[model samples]
Target: MTCTIFYSTEMPNEQAKVTGGIPTKPMRWAVDYVVKTPDGRTVVQGEKTIQRATFEELRAVMNHTIGEIGDEVGNEATFVSWRATAHGGKKKNRKGGKRK
Candidate 1:
């Protein structure tokens, strides 16, 4: 159970203080990458913290990283809310559903 958390803030004033001194300003969303499967393809977790300026940028990074594993193995990718996982499961992926 390996999980990587990414935080981004869209506010011009608020910045993400991640590892090292490198700070990401204008943060908006955060992505929690859950790599539980050996085959990879974990998640594209996006939330309020992901900044508007960096949303697509972050998404692109996630897509390149683990998207292939899930797309190839499960043939499905989704945008899931961590808040909903506790109850049941509410996930919404891209329209095409898992890139071809």
Candidate 2:
């Protein structure tokens, strides 16, 4: 059996900058979100949140998991489950739990 997984990438707007000592127009974004209130009725709204990741966060998590599984197999074998979101980023051994 195979399972389908969906991942979302969130990025912040390009921060405004003063170029050549000139100011530019501000950028705006529209979003939707949900909220809960005292009664069954809930307040749902969408707002912006500061972006906290680039895009490799998922890849790092996957690599870490693979490293852990490799350790369980008791070998220096590289976990084939590794994936990369970037073409040329530094590759580091997955950090896994130590074996006895």
Candidate 3:
């Protein structure tokens, strides 16, 4: 069935600037998604965690994912919402508290 998907991209750690030097590690991202119909029926949902060496590469990944989902679900499926947020340097525990 036709549906809309809401998704968000997140960087779990602080990003450093690309100064006049090369980095030794890549950046990671967590992309979470939820697909639901107009009447609130969930069709599909999942998260994809990926690492990239550059911002351009990250955009490429997101675009590819959106394109593939569109192709699979046909024109009726649309990504109506998208956001990019970052997490602080703290990991949460299962109880929703900050981990030490």
Give a tens-digit lDDT track for model 1, residues 1-100.
1122343333244333333222233333445544333344444433333343233465565556455646655745443212101111234574878765
Please give the RMSD to the true structure for each candidate, in Å.
19.0, 22.7, 12.4
Off by over 4 Å in 3: 1-25, 37-40, 82-100
- What clash count does candidate 2 reach? 6
Clashing pairs in 3: none
Using all chains and alpha carbons, the TM-scores for the candidates as numbered come to: 0.25, 0.25, 0.48
What tens digits encode model 3's per-residue C-alpha lDDT throughout 50-88?
664344565567677766765666635533233222222
Q: Write the per-residue lDDT of candidate 2 for residues 1-100, one digit (tens) a residue.
A: 1111122112124222111211122212122223333353433323332122233343344445445544654534421321121222333556774545
Top lDDT prediction, candidate number: 3
How high is the lDDT of residue 72 in model 3? 64
lDDT for predicted candidate 3 compared with the true structure? 0.46
Candidate 1: count of backbone clashes, pairs at least 3 residues apart or interchain = 15
CA lDDT, every prediction? Answer: 0.38, 0.30, 0.46
| Clashes per candidate (backbone, < 3 Å) | 15, 6, 0
